[model samples]
Target: MDAADAMAYLFSPQGRVDPYPAYERLRAHGPVVEIAPGLYVATGYAAIDEVLRDPRYEVTHEELTQHPVAGWAESPAVASLTGSMLRANPPDHGRMRQLVAGAFTPRRVAAMRDVVTAQATALVAEMARRGRDGATLDVMDEFAYPLPIGVICALLGVPEADREAFRGWTVDFAAVLEPEISDAELAVADRGAVALRDYFRDLVEARRRAPADDLTTALVQAHDAEAGRLTGDELLANLVILLAAGFETTTNLLGNGLVVLLRHPRHAAALRDDPALAGEYVEELLRIDSPVQVTSRKATVPVTPGGVPVPAGGRVLLLLGAGNRDPERFAEPSRFDPTRPHNQPLSFGGGPHYCLGAALARLEAQVAFPLLLRELPGLALAGEPRHRTRLTLRGYATLPVTVDADQHHRVVVPVPAGERGTPTGAGSGTP
Candidate 1:
């Protein structure tokens, strides 16, 4: 396909299933290809990287957001999103991020190692048990969705019993982010946004009355102005986005990572044999198949990215997936080789607007993947994998899989983070 055709194809259902080939087609044209007047799509690593880190290339803040998502003010989903740091620029973004950054510090994420281990183990073991008889299990439903949701819930101080409700809310909140949305979908997303907003409001009040050792309580303190600088609206919007975004990225990462590993059993075997290698493997997996595929930025002044001049007020859609596989940056771009030196993927984005929970998401993948490979010894795909029809938040909706009946995994013992290099005794049914 030509560059324009390739760009249009990205919004097609077929393109959404697998867009790498199309991305390559776009790359063949140039690093950045303008599909419309004052608008461009950056398919090369260098170009997208430059724009992402450049202050001149700004995110669409609330005032600018209306230009694209018209009627955003009336939509609850769009309002919640535009209010959060996700849409904030500079000073406001910095202030809000600082207030919540404490929750995801290195020490904090490291402390959650035990929590992730236990949650992933329990979920994987449960899948093993259900599939012990060669019964097909949708691993996406059984493992991928639950593990990340559980972890995010744990982080937000959400009680385990109340975690089930977030799934639907997440689906609703996420719908508004896709490449296309119908009126019905928009309505659903609005309801979902309102529900999430109200839920967090109640949650904040509860935290105020009976403070807990979770991020919610900390945010409450910040919102009340006694400890930090958050407004009540800021607290509500952030809480809604945090819980929704916190799980969304990791959920897609795990789902996409599994499909990659299952297709390349050799690499999966290697990871299982040496869990210590999971860190590098996860990076490669992320590079090969990014979860958040597209992000756009508007120009504040006339500037060039990848030698292509963008006039003032111009916009560029950063094709992150394409950038990750740019041949100029990565040798044999499409190949999934963890041994590549200096693997720097844009999966989590870059610069000021980079994902705040990036480290936490990486940790979740690193811990969960090895545990899965080791525990499910003979795990394999049982049927065609189903892809979620989303160009932005791309991943599998269902992955039919089964394990060797005789080798089904037993309950997992929580493995401490420091001891990851050592084997956790997978087949022996002991941690």
Candidate 2:
């Protein structure tokens, strides 16, 4: 297919299954291709990297608000989403990022290592119990979903009991990120946004009254009257942002990583042999198939990406998945090599708006993957893994697998009294 066809396929349902070939086709056409009126897609690594890190490129929040589509601008989900750093620009973005920066410091993330280990261990132990003797289990629900959610909820001081309800709210909240969400989905998204906003409001008030040693408490108690750093609206919006973005990235990372390992049995065995290589293996897995596929930025002034000038306010869709596998940047880009040198993928993005919780996501994957491999050595796919119908966020909706510890390590553990059986539904990703 030609460039236009490839670009079209990249956004199509079939493309979501595997977009790498389409990406290569588009990149061969040009570094930057105008897919539609005032809409460009950057295919190559250098062009995408430049566009993402350039100061002249801005977020599309203002344009979105001015030109509402699907009536999302009037929806509560859009309101909550646009109020945070993801869509913010300039002074507001800087201020909002600074306020939460303290809570996600290296020291803070490092301190959560034990927590991540314990959670991963508990989940794996439970999965072992459920899937013993080759019994089938959905890895996405039992292991990948709960590990990150539990960690994020604990950090945010969200009550453990309410996480089940949060899963439904988060799925709707995340629909706001879709490029073409239907009216029916918009209604669900609005309800979720309003519910999430109100929930955080009560939580914020509670934290203010009874300060605790958690990120929520830190945010609620944090104030500089002289500097005027945090406002009530900003606080609520950011709290919602944290709740979604915090867990979403890691959840997809864990799910995607496991799928890759399953496909490459040799690599899985290697990782199981040496768990310390998880850091490298996770990076390669992220590059081979990014969790967040596409992100956009508007031109604040005339700027040229790949020598193609984009006028002010023109939107540029940065195909992060394409850039990650660009031949110019990565040799044999399609091959999944954990030992690939100089592997700098744009999975977490770059520049001013780089993901704030990147380190935490990395930490989660590093801790969880090894634990999973070591505990379930005979783990293998039981059926076809199903992908979620989303372009922005890519992950498995269901990862059915069976564990046979007859030849490998055996983990026969009893499930806790309160958490014995499987959850009812598949989990969702936010942000």
* Model 2 agreement with the true structure over 113-155: per-residue lDDT tens digits: 9999999999999988888766778988898779888998998
Model 1 lDDT per residue over 163-253, tens place: 8888888887887776555567678889899888888888888899999989999888877766448877788888888998899889999
Residue 84 lDDT, candidate 2, scale 0-100:
82
Residue 297 of model 1 has an lDDT of 88
* lDDT over C-alpha atoms for residue 329 of model 1: 95
Candidate 2: residue 413 Cα off by (Å): 28
Each model's C-alpha lDDT? 0.81, 0.80
Model 2, position 367, has a per-residue lDDT of 93
**C-alpha RMSD for every candidate:** 6.7, 8.0
How well does candidate 2 score on lDDT at residue 425? Answer: 16
